[model samples]
Target: MSHEQLKRTALNNAHRQLGARMIDFGGWDMPVTYAGTIDEHMAVRTGAGLFDVSHMGEIEVRGAQALALVQHITTNDASKLQIGQAQYAGLTTPQGTFVDDLLVHKLSDEHYFLCVNASNTDKDFQWIVDNTKEFDAEVENTSGKYTQIALQGPRALEILQPFTNVDLGAIKYYWFANGTIDGVPAIIARTGYTGEDGFELYIDPNASEQIWNGLLEAGKPVGIQPCGLAARNTLRLEAKMALYGNDIDDTTTVYEADLAWIVKLNKGDFIGRDALARQKEQGLTRKLVGFEMIERGIGRDHYPILIAGQQVSQVSSGSPAPYLKKNIGLAYLPMSHVAIGSQFQIDVRGKLTAAQVVATPFYKRSA
Candidate 1:
C-alpha cells in the first residue's frame, strides 16, 4: 500500500518534514531513517536517539481477576510483577507456539497494561479478550488511545528530566510512573527495545507532536537524532532482542527462540504450560543461534544454513552490524550445532560461506 494510505502517527508530518525516508511498516507509514541507518544507529549507541513507536499496541486488562487473567495467557509469571514494574513475556498458543511477545506492566492490583507488537495488535487484543471471557477481567484495546515515543541511549534521562516534574531518579529500570511532559499528563516507563538505558513515553495522541518536537529540540545539543525503524531493527538485533514475524512468530515456540527464561512452566496452569513443559523435558529439536560470517559475504533472512555442506536450516534475521563492522545474523539450526564455537556454513547468494555460532548481544555498552 502507498504511504498515504497507511496509518499515520502524530509525528508523521514531522518525520516527513525532516526528510525521513518513509516506508510501509505493517500498514503504518513510518520513517525508516532520517539521516542514515548507520548514523542513527551510532547516535543511539554513543549518545541518544528518539523513535516514534506509536504503531505499537497498547492493551489494558482491568478487574479483580486482571492478574490471574494475564498470568493464564502469558508465558511469564505475571503474578510476580509488583505494581509499577514490567515483565517481558510471550503470549503463547495452546500448543506452546508464541502468538506474540509483549511487555506486561502491572499498573495496579486490578489493572495491567500489555504493550504488544504493532502488527499483532488486533490479533493479540482478540486473543486476550477471548481468553479472558471466563475470567472476571475486562479487556480493552487501547492502541489508538496513546502514542509512544522511545527516548533511548545514555543521554535520554538528561533530555527528558527537564520536561517532567516526576523524580526521574526514582524511576528505576523496567518501572513506570504517571507523570507529565510539557504539561501533558503521560506515562513514563524506564524501558526500551534497543537494550539501552532509555525510557518509553506514553503520551496522549494530542500531545504527541509537541512532545516529539520538544525532545528533538532539547536533545539536539547532545547529538540525539530522530531514529527510524531501520536503526531500531539493527539496534535490537545487536542486542540479541527478538522481533515478531521475523525472529519469532505464531509458529515458533519460545523455547526454540532461546526465550525459555520468559516461559514460567511452574507458574500454575498457563495456556501453553503443558506443551512447553513437555518440550523442556524432551529437549528442543532446533534452536536459534547467533552467527557471524567468517567469510566475505552478508547473510540475510531465509539464507540457507548448511551442516556438512548440506542444508539444515535457514536464517531468520540477518544484517551487517553497523556497530561491530561485521556481518551477523540469527538462524535456527539443529540443537546439536547451536553451541558456541560450532562451525557451519550459510548460503550467501548461492555460495556456501563459512560461519560460526557465537554468544549473543554482539555489542554491550559499558556501565
Candidate 2:
C-alpha cells in the first residue's frame, strides 16, 4: 500500500510537524525516527521519551461470562488477575501455535481489556467473536475509539506527575487507574515495553492532541524527546523483549520461543494447554537464545546461524547496541546448542564470524 493510503494515528500530524521519517509499520503509516535512532534510544535510557502507540488494538470483553471466556481463550491464568491488574498472555490454537500475544487487564469482575498487537487486530477480534459465540461474553473492538501514548524512561513518572491527579506513587507496576487528564477521562497504566519506569495513557481519540501537548510542555525541562519505532526496537532489544513476526510467529511454539511462562498448564483447559503440557514432557527441540559477536560483524534479521560447521538456525532480530556499543541479537537453535558460553558462528554478509551464547537482558536500569 502507498504511504498516503496507510492508516494514521491521532498524532500523525504532530509527527509530521516534527520532521519524522514516516514508514509502513504493519500497514500503518508510522514514524520510524525523529532526530536519529541512536539519539532517541539514548534519550529513553538517560531521560524520558514520548511515543505514539495508537496503532495498537484495544479490545474489551464484557458480560457475565467474561472471565470464563478469557480463561478459555488465553494461555495465562486469568483467574489470578485482580481488579486493575494486568498480565502478559498469549492466544494460541488447539495445536499449540501462537495466534497472537496480548495483555489482559481486569477492569472489574465482568469487564476486561485486552491490548493486542496491531497487525493481528482484525484476526484476533474475529477469533474471539467466533469462539465466544458459544458463551455469553460481549466482545467489542475499541481500537478506533481510543489513543495510546507511552511516556517511558527513568524520568517518566516525574514528568507525568503534574498532569494527572492520580497518585503516581500508589500505582505500582502492572497496575492501572481511571482518572482525568485535563477533564478527559483516561486509563493510565504503570506499564511499558521498554525496561524502565513509565506509564501508558489510554484516552479518547479526540482528546489525544491536548494530552500530548500537555505532556510535551510538562517535559520540556526534563529532556523528553519524541521517539519513534527505531528507538522502540532498540529499547526492546536491550531488554530482551520479543517482537512478533521476528522473534516469534504462528509456526513457532511457546516452548521453542522461550516464553513458557505465559503457558499455564494447570489453569483449567485452555486451547493449547494439553499440547503444551505434552511438549514440556517431551522436551523442547529448539530454543531462542541471546548471542553477541566476538568479531567485527553486525547481526541482523534472517542472518544464518552456524554451529560447529553447519547452519542450524537464523537470527530473528538484532542491532548494534547504542548503549553496549557491541553487536547483539536473538536467534533460535537446537536445545542442545543453547547454553551459556556456547560457541557458534553468525553469517554476516556471507562471512562466518565467531559468536558466544550469553545471558539475556543486554541492559537494566536501577530501581
TM-score of each: 0.98, 0.98
Model 2 alpha-carbon drift over 4 Å, by segment: none
In order, the Cα lDDT scores of the candidates are: 0.92, 0.90
Per-residue lDDT of 1-367 in model 1, one digit per residue for the tens? Answer: 7656899998888999999999999999999999999999999988899999999999999999999999999999998988989999999999898889999999999999999999999999998888779999899999999999999999999999999999987999999999899999988999998978999999999988899999999999889999999999999999999988888987789999999999888889999889999999999999988999999999998899899878998889899989889999998889889889999999889899999999988888788
15: Cα error in model 1, Å: 0.5
Question: What residue runs in model 1 are displaced by over 4 Å at the alpha carbon?
Answer: none
Question: Which window of 10 residues has the lowest lDDT sum in candidate 2?
Answer: 90-99
TM-score of 1: 0.98
Poorest 10 consecutive residues of model 1 by lDDT? 1-10
The TM-score that candidate 2 achieves is 0.98
